[model samples]
Target chain A: MLEGELLGVFALTWQAAVMLGLGGLLIYLGIAKEVEPVLLVPIGTGVILANVPLGGLTEPGGLFAVLRAAGIDTELFPLLIFIGVGAMIDFGSLLERPYTVFLGAAAQFGIFGTFFLAYFLGDGGLRLFDFSFTDAISIGIIGSADGPTSIYVATMLGSKYTPAIVVAAYSYMALVPIIQPPIMRALTTEAERRLAMPTRAQRVSRRTRVLFPILSILVVGLIAPKATPLIGTLMFGNLLRESGVVERLSRAAQNEMANIVTILLGLTVGGMMTARDFLRPETIMIYVMGVVAFALGTAAGLMLGKVMYLASGRRINPLIGAAGISAFPMCARVVQRVGLEANPHNHLLMHAAGANTAGQIASVVAGGAALVLVPFFA
Target chain B: MAEHVVEAPAPGKILRVHVEEGKPVAAGDRLCVLEALKMELPMVAPVGGTVKALHMSPGQTVEAGDPLAVIEASP
Candidate 1:
């Protein structure tokens, strides 16, 4: 009895053992497959630590618990990470092609659509799962295709399935290259994909560049007060970068601040995934819904692209619509690749980057919109 | 003789130059490949012409509107 009491092996439950294996798999994907390694590696480590029998890391007052309370609960980590993301992103592309903003907005239909579907499956209609309005909203934000926004919105809503939601969001985001292409190809004809956009965007004045973040904050904050925190921090970081005089602060936000927050946030998120909490039918459903959310978002964007393509007399390549997800340059690259396959000389990078960056803003706005709507409905 | 200056469409690194100075090229011929935002953007000839001058080489970074090549349009 003494040996059994002392030996963690003897105390290990099947769930814990399974969680340990999952942790190993996450780490393997990070290292071997090189998918979101920065977050996944730390998260995998945290999962391993949390699952070890009697580690107590996830117990009350333990490190994981403390970090969770301080960072995830308070929504500090995701907000700080936004600053880094803002600093790293150059709005130049978006500024060059302002019309792509519509495509970005259209892509957000996925979030609302998936939310309704998830809700209908649960208490809202079929009584299939335990997904609350808040839970459904949290799951749907995965459609935003932005990890920080996913974490921030999920945490704020206090959803029980945040761990599953976070995992699905990050994992599917890494799979954007695979998820977006087929849908992009299916939606656009060869002629639509072959259309080439003008390479040069009209020069944007420095004054306009400096004003963008400020005006964006004012406009978005007024429209969706709940989004103020998420958009505010992001724009502030962009302000720091575009302000030109604060290069040092911008660099710090882009690198050190972002890195530190990512580490803590990743670990906290991973530690939240105890096998008992993570291994549920709802978790599997969340993963499936995540793919649905992405497809819906991609399709919505493509539909808008087709509309704009017709409106523009085929000047616009509908493939750039796929870039309307928040996966950043990956979505943009996919658009470029697809456009090239249709016509080798067709380069859609600039236009796609415009839409991709716009998608970042639109995703945040959608997250804010959910934050507002979910509570009212709940 | 109408001379057209081909400007870099976007800021990026020149990955490969497909034409030499004095090389005759048709419209839409690839002049050079510019890599920007992790995507390869092939700058093509806007009009059929002789390559009068190549202003950029592989590995050189350029900004939007920077002259990439000078094309002397054929009569």
Candidate 2:
């Protein structure tokens, strides 16, 4: 009673110190390098808080734990983010170019391919890793290149590596600029990247815009009911934006709601990254497998885009196919930059955006499919 | 001088008024920035002109086709 513990230093273990260092690194990257600062900063701060000795931030009833329960564990934050994402997207480009959906679908093969590898390594037959079928599926969902979908699937499957999976998903997303370009360059040639796409897209009707979200929900929900929550929230947000009746509500969903949920989600995810859990070899393997899955997804998209380029009589820029990984404006921007590099006068932003938006829809569909398939196999 | 009016593309808030009344601008110069659907879209000068009037200000909301500014064509 006379000497109650004062500072957390005496309780600080090497693992905690490492985690704290890692947290500092994340904060550095967020502040100095500006790598996904919106996410990394909060996550980095959470990591520091959780790793501090006697902090109890990750313990039951703690702030991070509470946030995790309310948002990540319940899968509310990701879904809420989807509404913001949906409202923020303008699907007119996708509507004008429907065929790009094929590229999006093709990109999803990475999810399945990575699943098989992860299963074989962990639980399927090889047992090379500690990944159970559930764990493998959770890791594989990283290929979706979608943060919320990854969170939802990992949580739904009850994987032990949810933290790793979330980190991988967001990290890879932030690296989209660096990751996709090399693959895009490797897959296409000077001519292919230089291929000029039509500048103007056919105007999409407002009725069509309204109907697209509704029709998508029905079709997707009917096909993969498990994906209903993920897809449902996304389409709901899109519908709110497209309906032309609720401007204030849509804006709020896009800005305020998105920002609040993102902060909660990022912090909770970071809080989960305690050393004992995150330092395992399995976690390392998850990170490795995540890169593989993302690369495969990107390659598959490029391959499909090449096919479309050939099929469309060379009118399509295969670079746009690389945009099918659902990294949103980043992927589209990458494609546009590559296109312009090959041909200074060419403008591929809209065309790349078309495929990019389709990729967004397709990633959601793939996530729904994973929800259905993971349970069937696991 | 010929009068040219720039219109808003969609409903959004004016995030930035890049030019003021009587400022000379060339074609493609950004006159203002509009925040819509969480995207920052710039309203560019449609033609070489002098900004005659600014119909909107930062933080003001706008609707599709609402006039944003008026430019007097330069000859």
Candidate 3:
């Protein structure tokens, strides 16, 4: 019995080595490549632990499984993460330029478009990938550029592709730098990119700030009830921040609580990756679809932005429209940087930020819409 | 707390404070500057007998429908 127990302790899982390497890569990406360390670091550590020889941690009642069961399976973790993200976002950047909301809507087309493509590639016809209609829909939502919505929708839809969807969501978010610029340049001429937008004054009232979230929650909740979980958590966090009553909780959610959860969530996510689960033809397809989804989202947003630019008599920067996807500050920063590259005096951050923040809200709504629609379509 | 209603009157970065907290002021005086699309737009107190409150700060972001500073509109 003693010998058997010892043997069990060290018995190597074949994918353990591969998982360890993946973990190390995540760590390197976080530390050296500076790619979303807040999440990747914890996830990387979790991957390493889960893959270790006979860790038993991911076995029945193991640490990662427990986290998944208690938090993820219950859909609690992503909801909580939304609170932190809500607190971090500044909607004034969006509300000031209300029309940017359209850009937000435009960017979401990629979610549906990719869903269509993934479907055709999977059970729809070619049958090249392992995605069921539900999984394809969930995977395509990675285009929303939203972290929580991707996880939330994947969880709710009961898609086996949840881990890959989440990874694709977060990873593509980090890759915004690599994915967006070439597309933006390819779409617009240097002169068009150089076109300067009118500078608008910044003035958000505390009342508007407070009212915005409340109104948004009501509107979106009424429009798409499935989105309530995501929108509610997000608005609740914003309400806390704007209401000024729950400063301590908001601070904790935005800082410490978010930090702790990120670490745990990241690791748990990584734990889901066994070699069999990750290394497949379908996995490669998922990665490809993720990039395509982001690209389509960018193109759709820019197209709508062009309409806005023309309608507004060239008052709006088309580049700012690209920021309407869910990548948040990164997308907004990219738009601003690119705008400046065209014209040194060009300032698009505030405008891009407005669209980027709006993208957060729109993506949630899209997720909710997907949850409602995909079942019927499937 | 209940929400108060207000409007975005010009656009500008909030500069310095004119009225103190829990103070009274009339309309048509200087509020914050409305800076939009790179131009500084100044705003005056609108229909104000006393200052109810100011809702923004320097370097805060805002827009057209966004409320800038609120006034009691009643003495």
DockQ of each: 0.46, 0.07, 0.03
Residue-level lDDT tens digits of model 1 in A227-316: 999999999999999999999999999999999998999999999999889988999999999999999999999999999999998888
Pick by lDDT: which candidate is best?
1
Residue A148 shift from truth in candidate 1, angstroms: 1.0
All candidates' TM-scores? Answer: 0.94, 0.84, 0.82
Cα lDDT for residue A349, model 2?
Answer: 68
Clashing pairs in 2: none
Cα lDDT for residue A226, candidate 3: 91
Q: Which candidate do you rate higher for TM-score, 1 or 3? A: 1
The whole-model C-alpha lDDT of candidate 3 against the native structure comes to: 0.80
Q: Between candidates 2 and 3, which one is better according to DockQ? A: 2
Q: Model 2: residues >4 Å from true position, as ranges?
A: A1-5, B1-75
RMSD values, in order shown: 2.1, 5.7, 9.7
What fraction of the reference structure's interface contacts does model 2 contain? 0.00
Question: Best candidate, DockQ-wise?
Answer: 1
Reference contact recovery of candidate 1: 0.44
Error of 1 at A212 (Å): 1.0
Q: TM for chain B in all models?
A: 0.95, 0.94, 0.68
True contacts preserved, each candidate?
Answer: 0.44, 0.00, 0.00
What's the DockQ of model 2? Answer: 0.07
